[model samples]
Target: MRTHLKNDIPKFDIVHSHSLYLFHSLVTGHYCRKHGVPYIVRPHGTLDPFMYKRHRLRKMVMELLFENKNIKEAAALHYTAAEEMTLAEPVTFNAPGFVVPNGLNVSEYDHLPKNGTFRKKYPELNGKKIILFFSRINFKKGLDILIGAFDLVQQQHQDAVLVITGPDNEGFGDKVREWIGERNLTDKVIFTGMLTGEDKLAVLRDADVFALPSYSENFGIAVVEAMACGVPVVISDKINIWREVESNRAGKVSSCDHVQFAKEINALLANEELRSIIGNNAQHMVRDYYQWDKIGMALEREYTNILRTRERRPQSFKVRGDASV
Candidate 1:
C-alpha cells in the first residue's frame, strides 16, 4: 500500500484520508505532503474524547511520533458532524475543519418488509409496543442507562418490550443481561443477537420508537436509519447528531440520565399522534438531508473548493454545530 501510494498518489488532484492513528493515513499524508498534493483527513470519530482515552498511552505515543504531524499538515480536517469537530478540536488543534454528515441510500427504506414481518418472526413480541435499540453491544453504547430507563418505562407501559439487536462486543451483552436481570426485566427485554438485511429493516418498520442513549457517538447512523423508517427516536445529547434531530423536530433528545431518557421513550409510546408527527418529520429529514445523493453533492462541493483554493493555506474557522454544509 505504501509503495502504491508513493507511485500513484501524485496522479490524483487531492486525497481524502478516512481515519487517523494508522500506517495508511501516515503514509498517505506523507506522500501528499511530499508531492505538494492537497489532502483532507476525516477522523471518523476516533478523535472524540471518549474514544481517545481508551488506549491513552499508545495513542499518546502515536501522536508524538507521526499522527500529530499527519493531522497538522493536512489541507483540511473533515468531520461528520459539527459537534464532532468541536469535541475533536483539542486533538486537531485549530486545523482547518469542515462538517459533512454520513448519509444513507433512501431507496433502501422505500419498501421495507410488511408491518407484521418482525412480529411474525418473534411471536412473543406480538401485540407489544417495541422500543428498538439497534447497534453493537459495546461499553460506549450506554446500555446500562437504556436498561435502567426501560425498567422505568415498563412501570407505565407494561406491554412495551425492549428489543436489543446487535452482535455482542467483548462479552458486553452478558453484562447488559445481568443489569436487566437485576431489575427483574429479563422477561421484558429481548435480545435478537444481530439482525441484518430485510430482518433489520422489518424490525425498524414495526418499532414504536427507537432509542440510543450512547455515552459518546461521533455520528449515530443507526439513529438516522430508524428515522428513515419513520420511527420516532429518543437519543441522548452525547450523540453528535442530536442537534440535527432536535432542530428538525424529527425526534426527542435527552440527557444520558435514565430518568430523562425514560420520559422521552414513554412519551412517544403513550401518544400515537405525537409519534406519527415526529416519525414523519424524521422521514422527511432523512430524505432531504441524509440521503446519499445529497451528501455526495456536499462532498463534491467541498472537494472542488479545496482544489480551487489549493494555493492558499487553509484558514482556521469555527463551527457552530450546524448540519448544513
Candidate 2:
C-alpha cells in the first residue's frame, strides 16, 4: 500500500509521518528521502519503555537499519512532548526535532447532553457514579490495574459502576471478565466492547470520571477526548503528557503503583464537588490548548520552519553564473 502511494504521489516539501514503526511510514519516508524530499518523523510513543520491553528485538533491528537511517536523514523529528523528544534524540542519528501535542475536535463533546441511552441499556448505573475506562483492551493499557483499583473503590462506594469500553485484544478481554467474575463485581462492572458514533458519545456524556492507567503513552488521545467531554481524568505519570494533566489540574496524577491508584480514584469517587471542579478545568484546557485549530497552528509553525530552512539551502545549491561569467 505504501510503496504504491509513494510511486503514485508527486514529490513534495515535507512528508510528515506520525509513527515510525508503521510499515507505511517507513516505506513513505524512504521514498521521500530517495527523491530528495525532506520529511519529518513522529515516533508517537513507539520508543517508550513499555513499547521497548514488548518488542525489543524487532525494534532494535529496525532501529539499526531503515528507521534510524530515515529519521537521521529527515528534515526533523516531530514529538508530542519533551519525554518523546528525549526518547528520539539518542536514537535519531542526530536529526532536528520539535514537540507538538496530539490534538482533538474539542467541540464534538462540548455541552453534550447526558444521553440516557447508555444508562437505560445498563439502568443499574442510573443512580451511581460511573467511572469509565475507554480504549483498546491491551496489557500495556493497564486494564487489570484499573479493575483491581475499582474493586477497592467498590468497597467504599458500592454504588460506583466501572464501565469498560473499546474492542477486545485477543484474549485480554476474557482475562478482564474472569478478574471481574472472581471479585464478584458483575453488578458493579459493565463491559461494552467497542462502541462508536452515538453509542460512544453517550458513554462519554454520562461518565462521571475517566480513568486510564496506561503503562506508557505518547499523547493519550483518549485522555484529551475525555477532557473535551468535560470528564475528569485519573491517569498515571507514565503517560508522557502527564504535564498537561498536572499543569491544568485536569485530574489526579499518580505513580503506576496500584495502591496509590486505588487511593486517588477513591478520593474522587467520594467528592463530587472536587470532581466537577477538576472536570471543568480539564475541558477548558483541552479546548484552549488541544483543539485542532490551536494544534494545527503549532504544526503550521513547524512546517514553516522546515520550509524556510529548505528554501535557504537546497540539498545541493547551484550558482546561477559560472566563475568565468
Candidate 3:
C-alpha cells in the first residue's frame, strides 16, 4: 500500500487521507509534504473526546510523535459532521476544516423487501411492534442506555420488542446481555447477531422505529440507512448527525439519559400517524442530503477549493543562487 501511494500520490493534484493514527496516513502526509502537495485528513471520529478517553496513553503517544504533526501540516481537515468538527476543535488546533457527511447509494433502498420477511424468520417477533437497533454492538454504541430505555418502553407497551442486529466485534455483547437481564428484559430484547443484504433490509422494512442512542458517533451510517428506508429514528444528540435529523423533522433526538431516550421511543411507538409522518420526512432527508451523487459533488467542490487556494499561496521555500535554496 505504501509503495502504491509513493508511486501514485504524485499523479494526483491533492491527497485525502481517511483516518488518523495509521502508518498509511503518516506515510501519505510525509509524501504529500515532500512533493509539495496539499493533503486533507479526515479523523473519522478518532479525535472525539470519547475516543481519547478509551485509549489515552497510546493515542497521546501517537499524537505527540507524528499524529499531531500530520494534522498540523495538512492543508485541510475533513469532518463528516459539523458536531464532529466542533468536538475536535481542541485537538485540531483550529486547522482548516469542512463538513461533508457520509452518504448512501439511494438505489439500494429503492424497493424494500416484504414487511413480514424478518418476522417470519423470528416467530417471537411476530406480533410485536419492533424497535430496531442496527449497528455493531460496542461500548460506545450506548447499548446499556438503550437497554435501560427499553425496560421503560416495555412497561408502557408490552407488545413492543427491541431487536438488536449487528456483529459483536468488540466483545461488548455479553455486557449488553447482562444489562438486559438486570432489567428483566431477556424476552423483550432479541439479538440476531448480524444481518446483511436482504436479511438486513427485511428487518429494516419490518421495523416500527429505528433507534440509535449512541454515546458518541461521528456519523451514524446505520441511522441514515434506517432513515433511507423511511423508518423514523430516535437517536441521541451525541450522534453528530442529530442536527440533520432534528432539523429535517426526520426523527426524534434525545439526551443520552435513558429516561429521556425512553420518552422519545415511547412517543414514536404510541402514534402510528406520527411515525408515518417522520418516516416520510426521514426518507426525504436521506434523498436530499445523504445520496452519494450529492455528497460526491460537495466533496469535489472542497477539493477544488483546496487546490485553488494552494495555487494562490506563495512557496515557503525556493531555490536561490548557487546554493540551490
Q: Which ten-residue region of model 1 has the weakest summed lDDT?
A: 316-325
lDDT for each residue of candidate 2 in 24-106, tens digit (9 for 90 to 100): 76677677777776677777787676675677788778777778787778788888888767765656667888988888876
Off by over 4 Å in 1: 311-325
Candidate 3 deviant stretches above 4 angstroms = 312-325
Q: Residue-wise lDDT of candidate 1 within 137-248, one digit each (tens)?
A: 9999989999999999999999999999999968999899899989999888889989899999999999999999998999999999999999999999999998989999
lDDT of 3: 0.88
Rank by lDDT, descending? Answer: 1, 3, 2
1-325, model 3: which lDDT tens digit per residue? 7787787666666778878888887778888888887888988898889886777888889888888988899889999999999999998877899999999999999999987999998899877999999999998899888999999888899999999999998789999989888888898888899999999999999999898989889999999999999999999999999998999999999999999999999999999999999999999999999899999889878877787787743333222231100
lDDT of each: 0.89, 0.79, 0.88
- Clash pairs, candidate 3, are 318-325, 319-325
